[model samples]
Target: MTWTIAGSLAVVPAPTRTDLLAEPVAKALAALADPDAVGVAEIDPSLADTAAFCEAYGSPLEASANCVVVAGKRAGEVRFAAALVLATTRADVNGVIKRRLDVRKASFAPMDEAVSLTGMEYGGITPVGLPAEWPILLDRRVAEAPELVIGSGIRGSKLLISGAALAALPGAEVIEDLAR
Candidate 1:
């Protein structure tokens, strides 16, 4: 089947789990997806960020999901989580998430820390192959999208899969009001 994103981006068979450059993305797919249903496409490095990617690729913001790393501290120990929300919304780091984590405060993880911890690039940190210890929080809407586009753990590519495939990832938790 030919998979295209918003009628512009051509999505071909995703790289296999053994593909070194996309190891994390591959690992995630191996663990959570039906290999035949996943698709991937390369994009310009300059369009790696969400807005640029959506606009340049003819994908609507509503069809894109952003994965953000969040950090919180309680009892002198830092805890991390991955929050998935549609590009049209923002994660509720200060309110809902902070309360959910039971931390005094919760904030976006530092860029360097997010990249280092995920072993992914700054603009391509995806919830897919995140550390098993961290919770993968998905906004209700994100969990319901028929299909969506997300990072491939590298700036040069994007992963296209059904929302159900994403929610099935290990440790994914669907929550209402996760984004606003």
Candidate 2:
């Protein structure tokens, strides 16, 4: 099945272990994505954020997934996780995430902290290459999508992959009601 905007974009083979930020994402792609199934497309860095990307590239909002870093603390220990949800909806941070992380509260991670820890730009944190210890909480809706667009751990490019491919990533955990 053709992905949204696949015909109108300049997609190429996804970069494999190229940069610190892309390293894990590349490895995830290699391990989980079918050959040639994961496509990469370059974009203006200024428009790399989700809303602008979909608007500029003619990608449907429903076909775009956002990976957000969330953090919470309990017993003086802080934990971080990446949450993947459809661009049309927001992750259920206060409820589902907090419960899953077993923390009193969960919130979007501070920009500096997220970037520094993930080694990715503030707006380009994807689940593919997250630290092995962090759980990749994927929304059921997103996991059910046939194809979707996601960050590539950098501001200038994005990855196009099927939901099955994403769900199969080593750390991915399908969570029902993960988004609202």
Candidate 3:
């Protein structure tokens, strides 16, 4: 099945476009309960960043979600997690996230660490293919959105998925006020 969303993106079943996704993302797509429900769209790799992608593709910022990798440490032990929030808002890393991780401090993870750990590209880390041990904190607003455009674990494509599907992902926890 083929459909269009975000103004100009021609979305196809994600499972059918594994070549457009990173290996991990493609594997995760096949594992979803309804893989066909998720859609994939190819785009220019140079325009993968949220702001640029939205502007160039005619997608709205409100419908785009960013997956941020965060790191929190306590007593020499480090914890890493992914925070999913709307592009228009910022994740409360020092507040809700820090508390959630039970650490004294929380901050964005280094680019190299994030990319290496997730096996995904730097500008295209999505929640779908993150490490299973890491928590996936989903802002309540994002969990309630009808549809969202997110990274495909590669800079050359994007994924279109529903809020419900995201909330149902492994390790996903819907948190109130996770972003502001």
The candidate, 1 or 3, that scores higher on TM-score is 3
lDDT tens digits by residue: candidate 2, 44-126 = 88988888888888888789999999999999999999999999999999999999999999999999999888877878889
- Per-residue lDDT over 54-156 for candidate 1, one digit per residue giving the tens place of the 0 to 100 score: 9898988888999999999999999999999999999999998998888999999999999889988888888878999999999999999988888888898
Give the best candidate by lDDT: 3
TM-score of each: 0.93, 0.91, 0.97
lDDT per residue as tens, model 3, 1-180 = 443346688888898899999998988888999999999999999999999999999988899999999999999999999999999999999999999999999999999999999999999999998999999999999999988999999999999999899999999999999999
lDDT of 2 at 167: 89
> What's model 2's TM-score?
0.91
Model 2 off-target regions past 4 Å? Answer: 15-21, 33-35
Ranking by lDDT: 3, 1, 2
Identify the runs in model 1 with alpha carbons over 4 angstroms from their true place: 1-4, 16-21
lDDT of 3: 0.93
Q: lDDT at 147 for candidate 1?
A: 83
Clashing pairs in 2: none
Shift of residue 17 alpha carbon in model 1, Å:
8.7
